[model samples]
Target chain A: MGTRNKLIYLLAALGGLLVIRNLYVILLQFPDEAAQGAIYRIMFFHVPCWFICFTAFLAAGVASILYLWKRRMVFDNVAVSAVEIGVVFTATGLVTGSIWARVIWGIWWTWDPRLTWAFITLLVYLGYLMLRRAIDDPTERAKNSAVLCIFAFVSVVITYKAIDWWRTQHPGAVLSFRTGGGNIEPAWEMMLLWNFLALGLIAAAVLLIRLNQEQVRREVDGLRRRVHEL
Target chain B: MRFLRQAGTIAVKDLKAELRTKEAINASLSFALVILLLFSFAFDPTAEQTREISGGLLWLVFAFAGALILNRSFSREQANDCLDILVASPVSGAALFIGKAVANAILILAVEVVCLPVFGVFYNITWTKRPWWLLLVLVLATWGLTVIGTMFSALTVNLRLRELMLPVLVYPMMIPSLMAAMQLTTLLIAGEPVTGEDIVWLRLLIGFDIIFTALGIGLVETVLVN
Candidate 1:
């Protein structure tokens, strides 16, 4: 097979392995917590979803900043694709966390700082996409949205900090590094590390597909413009 | 110095036009009044009831009215392609943004002059409240609202869904400030006194205003370019 096909196969295989391993680790290997029981299983996927979401948004914000500085479409493409993926990850995190909340906290939703901040952040980016859809010109859309993405990222950071300090309905921080490996158990941390890597790889794989798709779309758009000129 | 002068000039220009047309304030105040009247009827709850929610109700009106003012603030430039001309000029786009934001805040505050006392009477907002503290919160919160609103307004002014997109773009940004404002106002109006918690909320509002104002001046150029 060609190199492109090889890459695709590699990504596909990586994705499959990630799914299988995650299923095995979460379902079979993960011990049922004495306190939370099977419900604690959701923590594996839930935490990773948030990690991916934050990374995706951070990537999008960085790409947006680069797009503004470089004035390149590629950065814009990466930014938009990352934002889309971020939205997906954020949504998954919110929904699954809420489910876990219901199962654990016995409530479907609460004004927990993290949950509220995440929800507000989700709306902010959704607003970004909505603004994107409203504009017709592509460059204007990219430039304006990039500006917005950068600013929105700042807002997100502030929201996270402000809400974290504000009323916190959700649980506290996961990392207590100041205490020297204090929060999660060592084995649990090991499991979390593996899941993070696997999910991160899958995110990268999906991101590659999205970038390629955007490249094709741009090419098609260019070709159409040329044909119309003819 | 030049930037400050340019921003001031733009602010003067907007205020002068507003003085002549009175379109923005007229529309904004009318909207606020109607909303206040409608809410008074809708909630027509007892005195304590009105006193309790008056803070939230007042801010809700201000937020929507602020949106209307923002839309009008930009739409004025949309006339005869004035926005294009202004943007094409060598003056600072950040100045333009700040000028418009300052002008909107002033006009909205003008609307508040008309809206607040009426709301006070209707909702019995006058209690053992500290009016000066309420005014301080109002001014700071409105600054945060206008700066952020002005930025988003610039983003959407040239778009097809300019009006529809304003709230969607700005409301999220406005939440922390607005909530803080509402809480402080609630405390003041409820005769709860300005406690440490309320002071913290005020600090948060001030921080939001300062950070966003800095952000607006920095990013306004990129927004206006394309």
Candidate 2:
């Protein structure tokens, strides 16, 4: 296999192992039996998805800034790809969150601060995609979409802090070493960290694969247009 | 200063053309009146309901009118290729934004002024108390609204779906401003004392204004360069 393909496979295997490890831990040794029980199992998947989404969006913002500064179409492509992946992960997070909420809070949706902010983040990116479709010129589209990505990033900051700014019932800092006080059990903590790393790596791998595919599609379309014109 | 002069020239040009045609103002005013009438008919229009919703209705009229005005504000420039002239000139983007914002603010405020009194008459609401507070909310919120609206309008002016895209893009960003404005307006109309909660919204309004204004100024060049 090519080097990249081999690396992707390795990462995929590692991710699978991490997921299995998390499942094993949850099945064996969760602290709470009554409050968490089977529902606590969802936390491993849901929390990591949200973390990946947040990381992806922050990367998109950085890519947008780089694109605007360097005037590179590659940076724009990367930004757009990152945003698309972020949206997917965000959707996964939202769905998983809703399921967890349904089990825990007895409601499918709550105006909990975190949930509202998450929904707003989704809308902001949705708006970004709409803005892209609305503009036609390739250069204008790149520039405008870059600016919009940056603006949406600003909004995300506001949304993220809205919980802290206005008090709501969403739990704060799920796994903070500084604030959560007592150390988590070493086994659970190790499993959690490994799951996070694995999912983060997988998210990066998916983004890279999608970016390559988009680039190739663009090149092939360009070649076809040229052939037709000739 | 020179940029401001050029901006003023552009603003005056727009105002004069608008005054001469009177098309946009008439269309917007008539539209606002129709909306007010529709709301009055649709709602119970009893004293209680009217008092509760009048501020909201007035702001709603302003928002719709502002959208219409934004959609049309660039028409004169587009029709006569004035944007190219402005771009070629030495006018700063901030100045251009401010000038356009000024014109939009005036047009929307005019519509609001005309509509508010008519609304008061229709709803039997008193405006004599807390006029300053009401004006303060209107000015701050509308400034924020028009600044963002004008920037987006300029950004989308060259798009194929300019008409549809403007509001779609503008409304989402305007949410915080709209919420704050509506809350403040509701408070004023109800004659509630301005408390810490109201100040929070006021601060939000100010924050939105500063951030968006800076964003518009910084990004306008990028928008117009292409």
Candidate 3:
């Protein structure tokens, strides 16, 4: 009944409807490609996961900077929530990409520049989480992890630039759909955007839930400290 | 001027302590040598393949042995609560961080200097060609390692699992610099000329060193203050 809960339900319902509609088009309505066939359809889910991952990580980095600048617990909470969600989406992106690779590329994995950077990015953020678990004090945890978060974002930028710096076998983005460039069919491109919108809504709902959980965690910690004093 | 002096003094203080005991240097040098010998037994040192991988092997030794040296940069302050004293001192956190990073770089560079030749001897590769270029790569790459290593050392110094956490946090960040360093070192070790594309790796190395150095100095105050 709370406003936050109601918002979550609204977003989830909207996202679910869009997802069902997109799936109907993808599985039934849309025609197969000339070259890669139905297998290439995984790009609908695969690319959006990366989009969400990058978006969440960018949010985490900005929140980290805000936390360090303002000394606000709210910013730290946002940073941690964004990073946790970013990590899950990054894992999803990797899994989906790997399955696609197994079918298309004839191997489960390759050390192509993008793939290599993706794996390293996964490790780096996982390290960020581990660093968080290692510290006890809430303030220290926030400060230290914020610092690491900034460094991790730099690595992410380096990863993105790395694809340009090195030759990559991974297919380049078809996002030039806006300018009407690239080889993608117009229909596939439209479906991609629809799926992204749905996924983004779902991810936002999850983020709100995560923020609420973090609020509860802080409250519990406050109560435990008070109990210790009593 | 005072800030530079403060930084210099801290650097000298650590170098003097390291000189007195030589514990880290001794352990690291021996560890580096042992790894080199083990690498020789594992790979036929004289093989054509060995030359291709020698750069990677040499840096791996430095990285592993360097971890031993870097871990002490801040944890040494924990003894007698010296971290508190240093933080309370007139020197700023930036100075403390730079000084410690500088000292760590010097220490690791010394180990690398010794290990490089030993690595040459063990692997039967002539690393003496273009000594100046090799030194430049070593300096840039070593500075890159210590900057992140020392910063993370400070970040994790107070943690319960400091040793375990430092490497996990630091190594992923080091990959870019390490990749650049490895490629340049591999090419240099083989006495090849630096072509246009190889120049990118060197630029990346310098960029990494500069970026992390600035970040370390800017943020150390937050990390050091309780």
* Top DockQ hit: 3
- RMSD over all Cα atoms, model 2: 2.8
What is the full ranking by lDDT, best candidate first?
3, 1, 2
Name the top TM-score candidate.
3
- CA lDDT of A168 in candidate 2? 69
lDDT of each: 0.83, 0.79, 0.90
Against the true structure, candidate 3 reaches a TM-score of 0.97
- Docking quality level of the chain pair in candidate 1: high
Q: What is the lDDT of residue B183 in candidate 2?
A: 76
Which residue segments of model 2 deviate by more than 4 Å?
Answer: A31-37, A111-114, A177-194, B41-43, B47-57
Across A1-230, the per-residue lDDT of candidate 3 in tens digits comes to: 99999999999999999999988989898778777788888899988888888889999999999999999999989998899888998899889999999988989899888889988998999999999898989999999999999989987776556666787888765776433576677777788888989999999999899999989999999999999999
| Candidate 2 chain A: worst-modelled 10 consecutive residues by lDDT | A178-187
Q: Residue by residue across B153-213, what tens digits does model 1's lDDT show? A: 8888788778788888899888878888888888888777787756788788898888889
Considering only chain B, report the TM-score of model 3: 0.98
Greater-lDDT candidate between 1 and 3:
3
Q: Output the better candidate (2/3) by lDDT.
A: 3
Write down the DockQ of candidate 3: 0.88
